[model samples]
Target: MLYYRQHFLHISNEGFIEIPRYIQTYLPHHLRVLIGQLQVSSHQLEIERGLSRGVPREERWCPICHTEVESEEHFVIGCPSYLDLRAEFQIEESLQLCMTMGDQWHLGRFLRATYERRERSLQLTHQTRVSTEQTITEFFQRVELHQRGPSIGLTLHQAAAQRARRRSRMVGYRRPQLYQEDISRINTTYNCMMEQRRTTTP
Candidate 1:
């Protein structure tokens, strides 16, 4: 129990606290499997009378930046790229200066922000897709109305009329509104990044 608590603290202090619960569950399962595999391999080698006794502990790779010497600090928050983002957020100053402690806080903030942006982008894309569906619906409705033959106009006149109708509807299309929302979202994100940078430090 003490080991588990210490392990959990170490992991959490490295900024794993904010990770979604499901992901955290996978960490323990994976760690158990890894240890079990290593132990079995070591026992096999011992039976074969090899020189080596057990599998050695190796350095972990940083999932975020893919650095070679991926310590908890490096993997979670010490990467230069993340530091750059923190710089933009103006929150670097408040970050834990000690590589270990600071990275824990930085990692939590960085991951949370990243997840939020991705979620927002996904929502925007979904809304855009819906808007496109609506536009297609509106276009077909216009076409159906035209086929009802209000006037026996020339080919050029019909083409021009269709174009005009489409344009008028597009001016008020949901896509445009969505685009505006996207612009605001991007601007807000940029501002947040800048604000954090100004506020924080390595």
Candidate 2:
């Protein structure tokens, strides 16, 4: 019982792992979910004991390198197909480094590098052709416009000044004219009462 209790505690500790705040701040929802599953060993890796409803039993092998079971550890650290990506991105073997790297934004870079590599591999394997000339042209044009002057037709200083003016206007607009008038009247009455008190004292 004690042995089982200790093992359970160890598993619980591993399962309750918290991702670093910096990693969480930038990770998109989908990537965050993936990371969460990785932490808890709950990802759709073939090594998971139970069969998923729609997936066939034979489909559990690593798609990239068909020699191993598609476990989370195998996909991230041990996969031979991503060796080039691992070298290019300088990715460490530790999964925790994805969240806990201190000196560099390693997690984001690693994810982007891996994704691009995977996308290229898929495109090559499937002979998929996507033309992005228009997209690239538009992006460059926008960049040129930004470099020349404000993309939104306002410089930084101008935008700040506009925001300040809007805020001032909003402050005034939030208070009804009737409420201001009432406040002015109340102040006048209070001053008059103070004067009366002074006169009566003298």
Candidate 3:
């Protein structure tokens, strides 16, 4: 369990979960941190910061978008900064898409582009951070879905069918001890009748 957490749940200084090293190389360090935070929701987003600092609930609008309340979903799927990138990749901004889509190679490209566009120009916006989380979440979820191939119900049905077939074969089976006892009784009766016939004939 410790090993699993180290490899998969490892947290960075920015409070983002660490991704695999192979995929990590494809993304900039900051982008990787953003992805990690998105996956686990541990980042210092405006909403969280507000809660920590006792800032009013109404003041949580995205620092960048300034239109919608800063949230993970809005940042990833609705923020305007990523609209062009999302459109270019034909990526729909939906949780359903995140959880069910099988292909996510285009997402990598989108992330790289987004990262480059805002790398040094501005402070990372709540939308961007949330978007990064959503993208990573989608990628991981796709991988998980691929790994879990068939449904649990199908596997259970197969196992139950096997057990039923085995039980059906046993229905007509008899114990060897019962057959042995019957044979022994018939032999003893025949012996006694032979002795009686010999005694009477003599």
Candidate 4:
């Protein structure tokens, strides 16, 4: 209900929800997705998405500003990262007011550019993290090889292989006891059947 309200802004009891004309008619698929994401709160900004990620309000502050919550309002107008773009678009304090003044195209353009900028930042952050983790893993691997020798490394490899085999079995494996009427009876029957063979073999 909250998502619907946010997407529609507001709706009357009898009103039908409609897609915005620009998004439906003129905008390209990518731009449509971008604009539609904001309308539906699927833009991956820290405000709503952060809530699902268990990010506290304090930590959900705008990465660009390092102050104030990173809401849609803050992204469109408050953050200084797009100051030049905002100035070029002649956008003042209130983005809603500016859109009401009929600069909707400017808003879309600003958002498209800003979203691309944000994506670049996110990609760079991910790359940095991956690189750091790789470096750390390599460092530890080298340390292990130097200090623990080849035998320990071989043991680690065997352990990893055993873990993989266990995981593979877990995919379709079911305990035999689950389908059996009585586990104790089944065990006793197997033991009785093997008793003569066991004695002869011994």
Candidate 5:
């Protein structure tokens, strides 16, 4: 709350806020996810995440900039790497307006492109099986599948297999709960016997 106010010009103070409209209007899932991440400053950018990972405040500077911390403001507007990207996206003004009130679809596309470049630049050190873009693609694939009636795209056998899986999950009793109270009682009895043995010993 205090943090956002410090960095941002517009911070919603209401009890419940609206999900940004561009998310629904935007067709690209990767872009949408990137936009949301950028808005919340929860993306791979150092910002505060580096602090949690034991990075010193001064050392958490942008890998690209090596001047200031990799905060949302720095990544979005201050970094030299994204100078061309900022012009491409028309993000020349306030960071708050560019992110919050600006054309989100355009901004989302910019973020997606920027993130890809960022990923590429950091690939030597930050390698992973699943990239942010891949996760977004897979997420939308599942969502589209569900929206199109779970088994719509599948063949007859695939549909049957899907149903079988659903049935198995729905009907399973799962692992029975191991009542922890029984273990507690056993430990108490053992401790009592051990105490008695010590007392009765010569």
Candidate 6:
């Protein structure tokens, strides 16, 4: 109910135009914090002085965009610094679309992109794979080339989990007894069996 209300307000009050059909299908239960964060982030640009705590009083500049980091809004939505990094692709347009999307999914996209860009800049230019015995550099090299977003990473992890489940089942592994399967359709059958048990009890 809260999600519906927030989404309703986001679309009606905010300039958000449309919710993509793909995301609408799942219809997540709640989104209060996500909506609040986006609202705050958008408003942060309106502030004059920077909001960051760590910067010295004299050198209060945006670490990413070099502009004076005046407000939470500047750090998030106003600063032009990330545009160069994002310009490697059509990240600016994507970010704009995400901001106006008025949903948590769009916020997730922004967060994922921000994390990826920061990690890419701070970490090695190329992804590093480390292991005890082997560096697995070749495997990481392939994954790095794909350059897909975090969503793809999640898909890969899900695929791996499915594969593991299949392998375990093939090896005769059994889940615990308490791991129940859906039995709603068999309710009548179960009632009949109970009746037979009562009849045969004599």
What local lDDT does model 3 show for residue 10?
A: 54
* TM-scores, each model vs. reference: 0.26, 0.39, 0.38, 0.57, 0.52, 0.28
Clashes, model 6:
5
Residue 161 C-alpha lDDT in model 1: 80
lDDT of 6 by residue, 1-202 (tens): 3423443334535667556432453433333343345444432232323333444544655544566643444544555755543443333343334444434454545445654664565354233322321333233333565675453233444666888887435566677553234465467689999999999998
Q: Clashes per prediction?
A: 20, 0, 2, 0, 0, 5
- Model 4 lDDT on a 0 to 1 scale: 0.69
What local lDDT does model 4 show for residue 32? 62
Error of 6 at 57 (Å): 7.5
Measured on C-alpha atoms, candidate 1 has an lDDT of 0.44
> Per-residue lDDT tens digits of candidate 1, residues 1-202?
3322443323455666443222333234543343233222322212122224332324333333445433333422355545556664434342223222233343444545543553565578799988886665555343555476443333444666888887445454574355888899999999999999989966
**Per-residue alpha-carbon lDDT of candidate 3 for residues 19-114, written as tens digits (9 for 90 to 100):** 544253555566556655544555555666676788886888766668887655666577797788878877655733542351345555665576
Q: Cα deviation in Å at residue 33, candidate 4?
A: 4.4
lDDT of each: 0.44, 0.58, 0.60, 0.69, 0.71, 0.46
lDDT of 6 at 46: 22
Reference-based TM-score, model 5: 0.52
The 10 consecutive residues of candidate 2 with the worst lDDT sum are 3-12
lDDT per residue (tens digit) for residues 77-163 in model 2? 687888877777677776545445522344445555655665677677565333453343354344554476435345445556888
**Clash tally for model 3:** 2
Residue 202 lDDT (model 3): 53
| Runs with alpha carbons beyond 4 Å of true place in candidate 4 | 1-33, 56-58, 143-202
The TM-score measured for candidate 3 stands at 0.38
The C-alpha stretches of model 6 lying farther than 4 A from their native spots are 1-59, 84-104, 122-202
Please give, for residues 1-202, the per-residue lDDT of candidate 5 as tens digits: 3445454433367855445556647557877777666666667788777967998877888876688899877887888888899899888477677755788777887788788888788874454434654554455344554465453245445556888887444565586665799889989999999999999999
